[model samples]
Target: MKIAILGAGYGGMAAAFDLLRAGQDVTVFESAEAAGGLAAGFKAPGWDWSVERFYHHWFQSDAHMLKLMDDLGLRHKMLFPRPKTVMYHRGKFYPFDSIPAALLYPGLGWGVNKIRFGLVGLYLRLTNNWQPLEQTTVEAWMRKWAGDSVYREMWEPMLVGKFGERYAQQVNMAWMWARLHARTTRLGTYQGGFQAFSDDFAAHLRGLGGKILFSTPVTALQSEADGSWTVRSAAGDQRFDRVLSTTSPGWMARLAPQLPEDYLKGLLELKHLGAVVMVLALRRQLSPQGYYWYNLPKSAGFPYLALVEHTNFVSPEHFGGDHILYMGDYLETDHAYFQMSQEELLERFLPSLARINPDFQPDWVRQSWLFRTPYAQPVPLLNHSRHIPAVRTPLAGLYFASMSQVYPWDRGTNFAVEIGRRAAEMILTDGQA
Candidate 1:
């Protein structure tokens, strides 16, 4: 069977890889010039490695992603680094990545709050039962079990950071559980970065007789009377035995007019948040204590959600000893940051850096870049799992895969690969039938 993959993201590429291994003819259509989708990156002239436009890292528990690299014979290029992650509380940053660190942190104050926090964490870690968690809001669940003090001190700030105060209440507990349960202090990345991994993945697909068309945006998916699907792009319309769309639900609704009205409505109904990020190449480190992730809270007068020093996580030496930092936030599509230019955003985000490190100077920043995406996070409301779109759409021979469908699990590269391969298996099974 000839397969067409719309969007050369990890999901699309993973699906294509599986189909190619099954001796199926596969072609990938990408709007961007390269692969990795949201994980795509760029580099400086003197830099040997690339940095992502949006920040990305893998947890130790990201089995699906780790397995893929090992299978691809690129394990040696992977780096697992122990990076310090801090939470900004009151006027200071406190180390809070591990259990011991959390207990030692002063924000929780007393014994009862600490005990409640530990018990709730133990429950989340020990139980594989998460379906019920989907029905409960993180706000309610944390308050009830972890108590108000623990929830407010440790979790509420992060909720505000990720979803803003407006949508934070609507977020379910399962999403929060996955966030805490899946991550590790030791983060993983490729030697040259995620972009290099994507390039290698694309090259590997091509080597296996799969065709990847870059700078080709798929405009529509139409069904032929003979049962095949037509992919219309800038190049022209081409027929395929099966087609998979790795775009957001909103894009899927836009691209496939042949889908059932009910299906299209469901796709349109999926709620999501966009991201605005400012990446900087600096002459000196941003965090003096070598902290990698700073989870900022709006309550503390932070203008953004997260402040990640990528160079601190890995090493500045890989990029000609340039300190790299990312100031990012997840906001509604209409947020003002989306409209702000690099200079405008810098003005808003930079002053806060001095609050972290007193010596931070504007001159420390060498170059800055602004990146914004309309679909960065999928909002998981109560019983969100039930609302998740199926990989097999109502239309025959056409499948859907996107970050939105990665419900109960936060959108990231690991689940992208997992769903992509799972969808590919479904397509092959259908082909056999």
Candidate 2:
């Protein structure tokens, strides 16, 4: 069987690898000149650094990703970086990575509030069943233990920032369980950077007799009455026994118009949050605190949302002793900040870093770049499970396996790879792949 996988991101790559292992002819089509989709990288001008187009990291529970690295013989390149996280609350920055920190953190109160809050976390981790809570709002779930004061002062800001106002109130409590499960321990990165994973994965795919076509975007996909699907790309059209799409749901909805009208409408109804990130290669480190920091600012004054001091987490020597900084923000595509030129965005983002470290002069920046992802994240509204797409589409021989299917589970490289493998297994079970 000839299987064509669209989008060479984590999900697409996983699908290709799984299909190849199943003794099927597999080919992957990537729109970008490189694989990795959102995680792809490019060379910076002055510093000569190679990094991901967007910031990415793997959590402790990312077993599938770890297994993939081992299978590809790239396991030795993986390194666990112990980076702490600080939350900016009410004109103050509080370290909040561990239970001890939370207990001592003043922003969340010290007496009954803190004790009750800690109990809530214990329940989330201990509770094997989370379905009953899935139907409940996150606001209600948190409010139950943390109380209204702690919810408003500590949790609401971050929730609102991640999922816009409309969806913030609707997020499932199970989502919090997944988040806590994944983020319990340390985070992993490659020896050089995440971009290294992309390079190695592409090479491994080629070595396994798999074909990958980069800079080739599939313009359309249609299934014939005879059950063969034709994938039309910039290069040409190719017929395949199966076509698995790991691209954005929005992209899939546009490309596979032959899918059921209800499915298409469901995909179209799902909204995504876009991101604008300014990555800087600097001469000196910015934050004195040893980790990533979320700057709330004076209530959304500037476009900058989070600051990642690359050197603080990973060694600067890995990038030839250069300090790297990332200032990230999320917005709708048409938002004013999203419309700003790279120069304008950088000009606005730099001052925030400068305030963090007085010594962070603009001249210290040897190179800089802007990465904008239009459909980087899905916004899960209240009771989002009903809207989740199935693994199979209405059209035969076509499958949908994007991040949207992993509702309540946040989007990440780990989830994408899991979804891909599961999608392939489903097809094989049905005697398709």
Candidate 3:
């Protein structure tokens, strides 16, 4: 069967790889000039390794991604680094990676508050069943399990920073539970970065007789009377026995208007949080204690969500001895910060960077890059699972697979690959039937 897979991200590419392995003809369509989607990377002239536009890292629990790397013979390039993650509250940064660190930190207070915080963390980490927690809000769960002190000092700020004002009573506890359970203290990344992995994946797919069309966005998707798919793009129209879309559901709705009205309503009901990240190539490190992630509390009065010193986790030597930092925020698309220019964003964040390191100077920044995406995060509300579209859509020859389908586990490269493979399996099974 000839298949058309839209979007050349990990998910789409994964589907193509599986289909090609089954002796099916596959073609991948990517709007961008390159692949990898959100995990895509860029490089400077003197840099030997590429850096992701937005900060990215893998947890030890990312089994799907690890297995794929091993299968692709790229597992040797994986590096597991134990980087220091801290929290900024009351004008100071405190290490907050482990239970001991949280207990020792003054932000959560002493005695019962500390014990409550530790117990809450333990509960979240040990939890494997998320169905019961789906209807509960993170705010309510945190307050009930950890008390108001812990919620205000630790979780609330982080939630507000990530979800803005909507996080107070809207975000689900299942999302939080999954996040806590799926992440480990040890973080992993490829030696050359994810873009290298993606490029290799695409090349391997091509070697398997699959075709990838870059810089070609699917403009329209039409269903034929005989149960085939017509995928229209700038490159031209092509007929495929099956078409799987790895783009966002919102995008799928636009591309294929023939979808059922109920399906489109479900797609529109799934909310997404966008992201704006400012990547800086600096002459010197910003964090004095070499912390990789710094979660800012509302008390800190910082504008952005978190400051991720990428070079702190990896090494500056890979980028010609320049320290790389990411000032990133997840916000609604209408947020003013989302509309700001690179120069304007840099101006606003530079002062905040100095607060982290008083010695930070304007000349310290060698170069800066800004990346913005409209669908960075899928906001999981109560009973979000009910809204997830089926891999097999109402259309006979068309299927939908996207980040939104990877529920309970937040959107990431690992789940993307999993969903993509599942979509391919569904297509193959249906074809056999």
Candidate 4:
């Protein structure tokens, strides 16, 4: 069987590997010059390791990604480090990584509020069933379980920062539950970098007789009457026995117009929050207490949502003694931030960096890069599961897999790999049938 994958991200690459292993000819198409999608990294002249365009880290519980590493003989490169995570509130930053930190932290308040916050965390961690939780909004659920003060002081700012004003209120509790359950204090990263791993994975797939076309975007897709797929790109058009699209639902709809109108409507109805990240190579570290991640409350007056010092988590030694920091914000497509240049963004955020460190200055920045994506986060609304499209579409020989489909688990590379493999299995089963 011949298969065509619509993207070269972790999900598409995973599906390509699975099909190739099963003796199917596979070709993957990627719009970017390199692979890894959101996990893709950028390297500077003096840097020995590539840094992700957007900040990325894996949890200790990312079983699918861990297993993929083991299978690829790259498990030894995985490193888990306990990095300090802090929260900024009322003009001060405090440690918020562990339970003790939460209890001691001043922002969450004292007595019953703090106790309720801890109990809510435990409940989210312990609760396995997400079906009931899906019906409730995060705002409502948090107010009920942890009270208004905890919700307002701790969660509301973060939610508003991420989801924006339009959809923040509609965010479901299941999404929050998944986020709380899936994360761990100990964060994981590849020893060299994620890009290094992705490059190696692509090489291994090529060794298995799979072909990947970088910088080649699939412009259109059509379903032939004889149950085959015609994938068109600027390069040319090629028919495949099966086609699996790992692009976002919005992108898939545009690429494959032959899809049913109802399916296209479903795809269009799925809203996503985009991201803009400014990666800075600094002469000195920004966080005074060596915090890796700092969640900024809305009251901080910063333009960005969070401050992630990548070198604080990984070592500065990898990047020629320069500290790496990522200031990221999630916004709707029409947000004004997306239109701003890197220089403009820096101008807006540089003062916030100084606020974190009084001695900080623009001269400390050695180099900087800006990255933007239109589909960084899928907005999980009330009963989002019912709206999630099936892996197998209505058209035979055409399939879909995306981050939006990885519901009740939050979107991540681990679930991307899982959904990719699931799509491959469905195709293989159809072939058997």
TM-score of every model versus the real structure: 0.99, 0.95, 0.98, 0.98
The list of candidate 4 runs beyond 4 A from truth reads none
Clashes of 2: 0
lDDT of 2 by residue, 292-323 (tens): 65546425454566788867777776677788
How far off is residue 93 in model 1, in Å?
Answer: 0.9
lDDT of 1 by residue, 1-433 (tens): 9999999999999999899999999999999999999999999989999999999998888999988888788788888999999977778889988889989899998789889888888888878889999989999999999998888877888888888878888899999888877777889999899999999999999999999999999998889999999999998999999999999999898999768888888899999999999999999987878999998888988888889999998889989999999999999989999887888889998999899888999999999999999999999999998888899998889999999988778999999999999999999999999
Candidates sorted by TM-score, best first: 1, 4, 3, 2
Best-to-worst lDDT order: 1, 4, 3, 2
Angstrom error at residue 365, model 3: 0.8
| Model 3: per-residue Cα lDDT over 67-146, one tens digit each | 88877788888899999999886788889888778789998889998888888888888878889899999989889989
Clash totals, every prediction? 0, 0, 0, 0
Scored by Cα lDDT, where does model 2 land?
0.79
Runs in model 3 deviating more than 4 A are none
TM-score of 1: 0.99
